[model samples]
Target chain A: MQVTLKILRFDPEKDKKAHFKSYEIEADPLDRILDALNTVKWYKDGTLTFRRSCAHGVCGSDAMRINGRNRLACKELVGDIGKKITIEPMLGFRILKDLVVDMEPFFEKYRSIKPYLINYEDPPATERFQSAEDREIFDETTKCILCGACSGSCPPFWSNSEFIGPAAIVNAHRFIFDSRDQGSDERIAVLSQSEGVFRCRTVYNCTDACPREIPVTKAIEQIKRVMLYNR
Target chain B: MYRGQSGMWLWVFHRLTGVGILAFLFLHVADTYLVGLGPEYYNELVFLYKLWVFRLAEWLLVGAVLYHAINGIRVVLMDFWESGVERHTQLVFGTLGLFLLLWLPAGIFMLKDVKWFA
Candidate 1:
């Protein structure tokens, strides 16, 4: 079928502002949005740019707004979104080029949350043993791929860039809820601040936009409960 | 922003209702202060509320209050209860249902005297 992918294009070195450019390409109905984009870059316009590492959903590099929703380009099939699809860079981020956004701000927030597990005790000869029930406590948050989809979809994050986003809260939940981890107090101090989990208004956009189907808002809420008690 | 998703619409409604309620509160307080001016002035203000536009606005205000209050409870539940997170969408629709269930009947009874549209 013939699909017209209307792409938001920006060339900081050349163009003064971003604008939409449509590329009509023949694609199989079942092809992923990434495939259609590849066709655009290869056979249509060489300047058409987007990020794709694995060409699959796992990498999370090709996350962008497709048809007014945040999704992974590799995961969303053309058949699902109909013939004409509007493609743009993710919201709440600076666009570097076509379908490419500057993810530095997102990563900075992730780093601020201390996503890595923190344990100061001497290293155990064997891995720390955690009960099956304890491991299950944080299983949902571990599914996050740090794609920035959840963070970008958040309205609070959009309004105040300083607001620690849903993705950061999700990542924080991963470590905060872990039974074997010991950084809960430190993490709680960071999250309890005005710019932290309290800023989330439960808008649920983060949950809706997550490609991995992670309950981003739920994770944020859980963090809020923890912060409320710890405060 | 595009009005395509349930989350965005809920946020929009919540903000709209909150602002509307705030505006109504100021007007309500201002009118209540008319009681100090004397019964004559207060009765005159109350009589003005019997107008069709004011009556119709009262029904709409009731709906706004119902939605905002119910949705506020949902937000509070989601924040405090761990299980509330898992059932967020259900709670949103549930609150809307409760709002309509209350507002529809109350509106019918309240609109009897106004008969503006009728």
Candidate 2:
């Protein structure tokens, strides 16, 4: 099948503003968007730049706006989208080049949430153990690949850069809900700020944009509930 | 991100209706309180509501209320139910369908007494 890929092109060094460039490529109906992009880079134009490490959905490197929805290009099939596909760099980020966004702000937000587990207790000789039920509580949020799809899809995050964002909240929830983690109070303090969970209007865009299919809205609400009752 | 999907538009509409209803509520309260002052004052206040402009707003308020009530249900379902999140786009359309079904009749009934529509 033939598909028209209209990609948004930008180069800070050369171009003053971003513009759309279209490419017509032939591919199978079941081919992933990453495959089509690769074909465009190789056969059509070598200047077409995008990041894809795994060429699969796991690495989450190829997250971009495909047809107005944030998705992992490697995971989305060409046939699932229509004959015309409009690809653009993820919104709410500086565009480094065509389809490659500067993810520093996103990562900064992720790091601000203190994503790592904080346990100050003396080390156990064996291992820090957790029951199956306890582990199950926050298991879903651990699937985040730092793709920024959820954060990029959020409207509030776009309007207000300070909003802690869904990705940060999801990361916080990962540790907060962990029965073994003792950093709940500190994380709660960070999240209790004006830019935290309160900014989320529960639009469900984050949940929809998540390639991991993680229940992002539910996790955010869980954090809100925890804040209400626990703190 | 500014131009969002169905879920984002639903959130925007919900908020807009909420603010509209709130503004209307304050006006409604002030108008209702006039009844306690005296019959003459209350009757004059009631006369303003019968004006064509206010009548038009009354129709709009009914539409706004119906939309807010239906979409509010959608928001609650999305928050509490796992299935609602997955089917959120469908739920938005469902809310709109319910809104139109109720609003069309309620709007006609409310505006039936208006001279312009009559």
Candidate 3:
């Protein structure tokens, strides 16, 4: 069957505004949307551009709006999305080109929360040990791949870019709840501010948009609870 | 435009109802202040509310307030409850069900005296 892919295209060098460019390509229902995109870029138009690394949803690349939802092109099948598919760059970010947005601002929020584990203690022989029960507290948040789907789908982030998005909070939760990590206090303080967890109105868009199936709003709520009770 | 699901629709309704309630509050305060001026002025203004159009708006206002209050409880539950996230969809439907249950009867009572059908 032939599939029609309507791509939102933007050429910063020449075009003043972005526009849609549709391409009809032969494809199997089982084929990934990424395959159709590749066919468009390789055969129909060399000017078409997008980002994809692992092409397996692990790398967190190729996250875009597929039929009005944030999803990975590589993981989404043409059959699942139907014959007519509309693709656009993820929301709440600067669109650099076709299907690619500048991820620096998104990464900046991630860095603000100190994503890495912060522990300053004497080494425990070889490595830090933690029980299975302790690990289970934050197990759901560890699956995040920073795909920007959750943050992009969020309305608060869309209206106010200053808001620390769900992705950052999820990353913070991973370390904040870890028994081996000792940075919960600092992280909680940073998230308690006006631009932090309070900005989240529990819209649950982040929870719906997560490609990794992370319980994003739940993690953010947990962080709120930690801040409230710890004080 | 983002094509979000039930959660998004709930958020949209929550926001709109909140704003609508606030607006009604302002209008109500302004109208009630007419009571301080004189009974004649106040009753004259209040008499306009008996019209069919204002009666319809009153029903809408009641619906808005009921939905907003019920959904607010749902949000609070989601924040504090451990399994709230997992049961969010169910909670959304429950909120709607409860809103209709309360609002429908209130609508019947509020509009009973209005002779719209007659």
Q: What TM-score, over all chains together, does every model reach?
A: 0.91, 0.84, 0.96
Error of 3 at A17 (Å): 2.9
Tell me the tens digit of each residue's lDDT in model 3 across A82-125: 99999999889999999989999999999989998899998778
Q: Is the docking of candidate 3 incorrect, acceptable, medium or high quality?
A: medium
Give the residue spans of candidate 1 off by over 4 A.
A14-16, B2-4, B29-48, B115-118
Instruction: Provide backbone clash counts, one per model.
Output: 0, 0, 0
Candidate 2 pairs with clashing backbones: none
Query: For residue B30, what is the lDDT in candidate 2?
Result: 92
Model 2 TM-score is 0.84
lDDT-superior candidate, 2 or 3: 3
Q: For residues A108-180, what per-residue lDDT tens digits would candidate 2 score against the true structure? A: 8788878888899997899899999999999999999989999989888888988889999999999998987
Which is superior by TM-score, 2 or 3?
A: 3
Which residue segments of model 2 deviate by more than 4 Å?
B1-6, B18-54, B69-105
Predicted candidate 1 versus true structure: per-residue lDDT over B3-75, tens digit per residue: 2367677778999999999999998998899999998988998987888889989999999999999988988
Model 1 clashing residue pairs (backbone) = none
DockQ of each: 0.53, 0.34, 0.68
lDDT of 3 at A92: 93
Model 1 misses residue A136 by how many Å?
2.2
